[model samples]
Target: MRILVTGVTGRLGQLVARRLLESGHELIGIDRRPWDDAPAGIEMHSVDLRKRAAEDVFRKSHPQVVVHMATVTHLIERSEERYRINLGGTRVVFENARACGAEHVIFVGRHTYYGAAADSPLYHKEEEPPMAMTAFPELADLVAADLYACTALWRYPELCTTVLRMVYTLGPTGQGTLATFIRGPHVPTVLGFDPLFHFMHEEDVAAAICLSIERRIRGVYNVSGPQPVPLSVLIRATGRTQVPLPELLFRAALGRFGLPRLPPGALTHIKFPIVVDSAAFRAATGFQHQIDEAGAMGEYRDAFPAL
Candidate 1:
């Protein structure tokens, strides 16, 4: 099969492209900017999807499966920019896939689209309703528009589309709250309690995308690790000493810095457990994580020896 991946430079997309190549598929990788560092032999298109004719570029490649991993990420705070690129880029990708007669479309979605509350549920099935966007105003702005674009693709049954609502995908290349916590000056464990978090290894996420492409499964599926680990356990695995920050002191310091105090919603998230039910995806495919939590941490540690 010939596969084309957008966001080929992102951590997840790059890994997926590598796995697809290993599985004997030819790849056409596209990103807004060229990656001189991308693995050799990947046929790359350096055009910006927002400004250029994305459909024409894709038509020339004529890939069988279109794995759409590109998005305006969370750290990009400008909502208007996110709306233009994340939401707009997805619409363009899906429409282009249909026009180009691609067999399938696989999307990487966020679990936060479910809700950030830790006690919300152990796992969210694909059939469950998305967290009320009105209430989660902040996250809603980033994910809701993209979710709509996802639903639009499903209306065409001829296009086999799968939305992989993924958890905090982490490995060495990951950055964000989890990465900050992992590469902390000292490991900080929850003093009172910890929320349940599930992580997908970069390689496993890549493998899941390949599995979906090969199997041609359509529908939303949860992509996550088999085991759900507590934040305390993750801190210990990093071989760093834990400094228990009292909730009061933590809030006070954040306040002094003029940072928003951890809202009850965010705090509850770290104290309770939330798991991703990956059984459906696992049952459909034989692949599982090549690295567990400890192994993943070891890999991250090795990648940055100073840490």
Candidate 2:
């Protein structure tokens, strides 16, 4: 199959691109960032997803499968730019997919859209509406992007649209929200709160995406791996010292003492857990994680030693 992948320069995107290439699929990549070392045989295009040049890639390649993983996930960027890239980029991807006559369109999303709260269910189902807009306003654009991709299912009945709300990924790159939070010597935690953290190895995440494409699964599904563990256990496994602080102090201490700067809304995530049920995805694609929780944490720790 001919596959066109957006954000092919990102860590997860690279993994998925390589996986597809090994499986004998012709790949076309689009990303604003330059992939100087991109493996041979991939037709690379450097362009923002929202721009007109991105549509030209679709018209020329005419890929049968489209994997959208180009949304911004970090908070460092200005909110306006983030919204334009995340939401606007996604809208354009779906529009192009439909216009170019793509068969399958998969939107890779995060499970954190469910929002962590004291009242949140232990395991979130795909049918539940996203609550991050209120609990974590920083993620509003991501939620909107996911919702927009989901709408394509009904809006364009001919397209096979799959919205995958995947769990946090831990791997050698140390490039995800969990990695950033635990980067410093001391990992911060809200006092009296030990929320469960759901995560999987980066390789497993790539395999899940490949499975979704191969099976042509449609609709929304939560993609996860292994069992969930407490936040404290994760910190310990990564060789970081856990620092418990009062909610008030936790907010104040961010961006100080070698910690990464985070928005005020992120505290809710540190205090509560957002776990999702992946039975739907498993049933659809028979996807199982290749690396266990301990292996994933060990690989990350080995890659980035404790400071």
Candidate 3:
């Protein structure tokens, strides 16, 4: 099968691209950043998804499978630019896919769209309406992007669309939300709160994406790996010192001592869990995580030892 993957330069994107290539599929990548060392035989196009050039790639390649994972997931970028890339870029990807007559489109999304709150269910289902925009305003664009991709399901019934809401990822790159939070010498936690953190090994995440494509699964699903573990256990597994700080102190201490400068609303996330049920995804794809929580944490620790 001919597959076109957006955000092919991203960590997760690279993993999925390589896996698909290994499976003997024709691979083409689109990303604003150049993959200078992209493996042989995988065609790569350095182009922004929101530009007409991106559409040209879709028209010329005429790929049968489209994997859209080009949205910004970090908070470091300007809000307006982030919104444009996350939401606007998503709109363009779907439009181009449909216009180009693609068979299946997969949108890789974050499970954080469920949001963290005292009232949230222990395990969120795919049908639950998104609440991340309400709890963390910074994530509004991401939620919108996910919802927009979901609309493709009914709006364009002829196109097989799969929306995957993936949990946090931990891997050797040490580049995701979970990695950054625990990368510093001292990992902070809200006082009297030990929320369960749900995450997956990067390899398993890539495998899940590949399985979805190979099986041509459709509809929205929550993708997770292993079981949920307390924040303290996760910190200990990563070989980092856990520092329990009051909510006020935690909020004030952002951007200091190697800590990430998160928005104020992110505090609620640390205090409450946002776990999801992946039974639907597993049933659909027969997906099982190859790496357990301990193994995933150990890989990160081996890649970047405690400071």
Note the Cα lDDT for every prediction shown. Answer: 0.69, 0.93, 0.92
lDDT of 2 by residue, 1-307 (tens): 9999999999999999999999999999999999999999799999988888999999989999999999899865447989999999999999999889999999999999999999999999999988987978899999999999999999999999999999999999998888888888888899999999999999999999999999999899999999999999999998989999999988898999887789988888999999999999999999989899999999999998888
lDDT of 1 by residue, 101-182 (tens): 8888887777666765534667777667666353445555447654754685557778888888776756778553455445
Displacement of the residue 173 alpha carbon in candidate 2, Å = 1.0
Ranking by lDDT: 2, 3, 1
- The lDDT, on a scale of 0 to 1, for candidate 3 is 0.92
Model 1 whole-model lDDT (C-alpha atoms)? 0.69
Model 2: ten consecutive residues of lowest lDDT: 72-81
- Worst lDDT 10-window in candidate 3: 71-80
Better of 1 and 3 by TM-score: 3
| Residues 19-113, model 3: lDDT tens digits | 99999999999999999999997899999898889999999999999999998988654489999999999999999999999999999999999
TM-scores for all predictions: 0.86, 0.99, 0.98
Candidate number with the higher lDDT (2 or 3): 2
